[model samples]
Every structure is written in C-alpha cells, then in structure tokens.
Target: MNDSEKISILSKLISFKSVNGHEKAIAEYLQELLNKYGIESEIVPVSDDRADLVAEIGSGTPVLAVSGHMDVVDVELANWKTDPFTMTEIDGKLYGRGSTDMKSGLAALVIALIELKQSNTPINGTIRLLATAGEEVGQAGAELLQKKGYMENVDTLLIGEPSGYRAVYANKGELDITIKSKGKAAHSSMPALGNNAVQHLINVLNKIQASIKGYMDIKNDVLGGTVFNIDVINGGTQPNAIPGSAEAVLNIRTIPEFDNKKIIDLIQSEIDQYNNSTNGNISMEIGMEIIAIIGNVNSKIIDLIKTIAQPYMSKIKYTPEQIKVAEKQSELTGMPFSTTEIKTMGVSGGTDASKFLIDQPNNANYVVFGPGENNAHQDNEYVTKEMYFDFIEIYKKIFVEFFK
Candidate 1:
C-alpha cells in the first residue's frame, strides 16, 4: 500500500470507538480488512463486546508476531480540537484519539504484512498480526491470548506502542493497590465525636510518600526507580458526617530490581508501621499486579531490531516548534530527543509486551517500537504523517532482514 492508502486505513481504524471495554467493532473491521488481502484470521473472544484478532502469514519454527492493542483510553470529547473519532490532518500531523496512542501503528503493521504477502516473497518463518482488546484497561486480551496458548510458538514479539522512533527494551512494572482506612461516623455538629477516616487516610498517604522517597534512592539506569501515584480516593457519605470508611487507589511502577510482590511487601511494611502507631484500623490490598520486564539485550531479535533501525535513527529529527509541542512527551518518556539520540529508553508505563514476556520468558523476545510521538493517553494526540509512512518501510525492512 502507498502512503495515502496507509493513512486511509488508519483513518478508518480511528473511526471506531473501541474504548477500553468496547473493542468488537474495531476488531471486526480489522478482520474484514485482512480478509480483503485473503488473510485468514481468528477472532478470539475476550468478553461480550471485546475480542482479539490474530492473523498469520507464512509458517515455520521461529514465528514472529507483530502486535498492537485495539482498545484506546476513553476520550473526553469536550476537550478535543477535532472529533476524537475523526482522523484529521493539519501541518503534516494527523490528529485523532488513537492516531498516536496506537491506531497508526496498528494500520502500519497490517499494511506492512499485506504488502509482504503481495510481494510473493518466500519467507522462511511466520509473521503474525495480533490485535488485542482491553489494553487500555489491564491487557486482558493479551493475558487471555497467553492463557489460550496463542503465544506458544512465537519466537519474537514486536509491540506497536507509541515510542517516538525509539525501540524500547525495558519498562517499569505496575501494581494497583487499594488501601482502606476505617473509623467511626458521627454528626457534623458533634465535636470530636467520631474518628475522621478521611484524615486517617491522608495520614497514611503522607507516610507512604515519605517512605517512597527513601525507596527512590534505589534506581536503575534503564528502568529507573519505583514510582507511586494515588489515582483515586473516596470517603465520607455526607459533608455533615465523619466517614466510617475511606479508600485510596495507588499505582506503583517499579523496576526489575523489585517485583510486584516485593513492592507490595514494601507498602505493607509502611502500612504495618502506621497501623501499629494508630488504633490499627488501616489496611491495604493488591488490586492489580503486572510484572516489570527487562529484555535480553543479547537476544538475536534485539540486535536485529537495532540494526534495522540504525539507518533510520538519523532520519528522526524534530522541528523547533515540533520539539516545543512535544515537551511534555519528552519529559514523560525521559527521551530528550531534541539533543539525544533516539535509542532504547524505559517506557514510563506498562504495555501488552509484558504479558507476552511474562509467560515465555526464555524463548520469546519482546520489543516495543513504533512511529508515533509520545501523545499516548494525552489530549490532542497525533502521529506525524512522515513517521507513519516511514514505519511501513521500517517494519517491511525488519521482515526482509529477519527472513533473509
């Protein structure tokens, strides 16, 4: 497919509102698109309205899977410059909800595989396209795929996540923890009649933050140190009454130095201390757990990806204004691209890549690479037209190089 055709495919992909739990429409669209190329695919059900679409070309031992997620984070329509579902292009950048977060990469991967099929080239190994659902939520689609043995034969996995032009080899582990503080409820007019659960929750949060500061001293150059964020909190039934219970959700991103269990222990230790000091009503529990992944730099696939990307690295440049626009991305990704080379960097959050790596740790090689800027999960997200075009060539070359 040509550049226009690729963009057109992406535009169609963005048109589907496949947000988090709702991915059936987009998955069906991709299944139909692949069918037009005579590619056979399987739609694995993830839930009532979500599924994973898996299609393959060629066959052999060292199977390679090019993957991307079908689901995108929910968009607040009122904040968008254009309809979040409509692909809009202006000044060389394509803007839309999932244009950068992943639809562009998803389109590029599909088109690249289709082009490879049309070339009539004899590939020695398999190339699979795996588009999954619920990635924006917790990677349930990918987890289900792994559980069903779909990833068993895969030798290498390439995730089409937004990474500017860099190939990411490591990412921080993520854990969602819910902590509850218990207290007695009393009328607002009463003075000191009830223990304030909200106040107790705040105290626990403060202690956790202080403890994390010390933990931050332990760091890795690639994945960095463990980080924490309080995502949600709820307490108090009415303004007049002291709450009986309060809850706060915490998200912790950790390096390979610490696993999910280890981080939980750390947080529990803090909670234990707080509980001992207080009436011992504070409690914590793990809500979600995703392990951190540090790829084998010595893996043959990693070397191959770096080799394939070298020539194009110099081609990745940012305009002064473009750099200005991507400042927040630069900060979030820790990629000072205006001055530094576009090479391996730790992803600030998790991806479906981790799901594949977790199960097939020994044989499967995983790398997150894509063409879009780091506008993922951000407002006014976009992917450059130039980069989108370039990614098609990049993915094509990698296949050619790997098969050769």
Candidate 2:
C-alpha cells in the first residue's frame, strides 16, 4: 500500500471516537475493508456496544495473530492544536489523538494483510488480524477474547502497541489498592469529642509510602524493580464537621520476580499496623486489586525475530555499551532499545498483551511492537509519519518471512 492510502485509513480511523468500549464504528469500517480483501472475520462483542474484530486469512495450528487496539484515550479538544479526532498533517507529523498511540498500528496491520494477499504468499499457518477494543480501559476486549478461547490455537501473537519499532517482550504487572479509614464525626467546635478520618488516612499513607520503599529492594534482571504511586485519593465530606471517612488509591507496578500476593499482604499489614498504633477509635479497610500482564520472552520467538532483524541490524540505534556487548552476541538482548528482540524482562506499564497472556496463559507466544512516541496516555500525543510507514514494511516482512 502507498503512503497516501495508509494516511487515509489512519485519518478515517481517528475520525471515529472509538474510545475504549465505544468501538462499533471502527469495527464496522474494518469489517468492510477486510471483506473487500476476501478475508473472513468474526466479531467478539463486549458489553457497551464495543467489539473486537478478528480476521483470519489462513487456517491451522501455529497461527500468527497480528493485533492492535481499536481504542484511544479520552481527549480534550481545547488542548489540541487542531481537532483531536481530525487527522492533520504539519511538516512530517500526523496530528490526531490516536494517530501515534495506535490507530496507525491498526492501519499498518490492515495494510500488511492487504499486501500479503496481493503477494499470494503461501503460509503453513493461519494469519489472524485482531483489532481489540477497550485497551485504554483495562484491556477488556483482549480479556474477553481470551475468555472466549480466541487464542486457543495461536502460536505467535504480535500486539501493535506504540513501541517505536522495538519489540517489547516484558512489561510490569499492576496492582491497584484502595485504603479506606473511618472515624466518628462531630461538630468542629468540639474537636476533642470528634475523630478525624482524614488525619488517620494521612498516617496510613505515610506508612504505605515507606512500605513501597522497602518493596523496591526486590528486583530481577529483566524487570528491574517495582514502582509505586498514589494516583488517586478521596475522602471526607464538607470542610467543616470533622470528616468521617477518607480513602487513598495506590498504583503499584511489580516486577516478574516478586510474588504479587506477597506485595499485597505487605501493604495490608502496613495499614493494619498503622491502625493499631493510633489510639483513636478509627477503623481501616484495605482492598487490593491486581491487573497484571505477563512479562516473559519465549526463546524460540526471540531467536526467530532476531534472525529476521539481522539484515537491518545496522539500522538499529543502540547505546555504546550495548553495541559493544551485543555486537557478537547471538541471543536477543533485553535492553530497552532492542526492539527487534523478544524481551525476558518486565516493565511498569500495562498493555493489551497482559490481558491476552492472562486469558491464554500457555496458548500463544506473544510480544508487543509498534511505532509512535512512548508518551502514551499523556498530553500532546503524536507519532511520526516516517515511523508509521516504517512499521508497515517491517510487519509485512515479518509476516511473509515467518509464515511463508
């Protein structure tokens, strides 16, 4: 496909507000395009009118699943230079809300399938194109697809996330914890007679923060260490009348080496200790929720990807130390810049790949690859037009070379 056609497809996709679970329009659009190419597809619908589109070009075991999310993060039009939904070109940059963060990846996969068809490449395995919905909202589409047994026979799964042409084999798992504290309420004038839940919550938060520091000591070669943040907190009623209830939300990214349950128990213990230390008649409850994505590289897949990428090794930009050490290395490296290699490490961010892994477990060998700025879910999101086209060529080659 030409750059113009690619740009057009991306523009049309961005025009639709397929935000999280609202992917109906885009799913329909993709269905029509895939139909035109004579590819058969099926829709795995999630609640709220959102659905994931799966198009299979071939059949049999060792299926290759090329996937991308059909959702974009919420956008504020006023904050954008142009309409966030309208695809605009200035210099060499394509401006749109999901342009880089991954509508472009969908375009690449679509174009790759179109090209593969035109090439009449013979494959021994199935080539599945999965356009998942709700990746921005907890990866619900992938989660559902897995539950429905979509990945049952798949051998390799490639997730089109914006990783700038790098292969991401490992990412950190997430745990979201909510801590609530309750206290008796009374008139502000009689402070001695009343208890403050907000104050109790502050003490609990301090203890949690310290506990996070201790958790960081647990590390792994691939995953590094866990990272923690107090992303949300809600508590109290009005400013007056001693607040009766307070709560804080903690977001923790865990490495592969750490047992997720152990971390949860540690956080709970810290809160319990804080409650016991306080003489006030305050009660506390801690709720821990985990949203983990598996982070391990399949050695066979890593070797295959490296072999495919060897011809373009000169094009890869590596740090000085990495270049010297990896120059003669046959195994795929785990550093951040080695996008073509399957990673055995984990990171702090979660993706649809996590959902797929959770559902399938041992069903498929999966990795994430794409083009765009790493600043996903951030303001002023943008992806380079060059990167968009480059990924198309790379993906096309990988499919043809590996499957044929």
**Which parts of model 2 have CA positions greater than 4 angstroms off?**
236-241, 275-346, 359-364
Worst 10 residues of 2 by lDDT: 281-290
Whole-model lDDT values for every prediction: 0.81, 0.73
Residue pairs with colliding backbones in model 2 are 166-339, 167-339, 171-347, 172-347
Top-lDDT candidate index:
1
Lowest-sum lDDT 10-residue window in model 1: 333-342
The digit string of per-residue lDDT tens for model 1 on 3-85 reads 67788899999988887767878878888988998889999999899989999998886788889998888888888899888
Candidate 2 residue-wise lDDT, 325-377, digit = tens? 65444233234445354334444567777777765433246677777765566
TM-score of 2: 0.85
All-Cα superposition RMSD per candidate? 2.5, 4.9
Task: Score candidate 1 by TM-score against the native.
Answer: 0.91
- Each prediction's TM-score versus the true structure: 0.91, 0.85
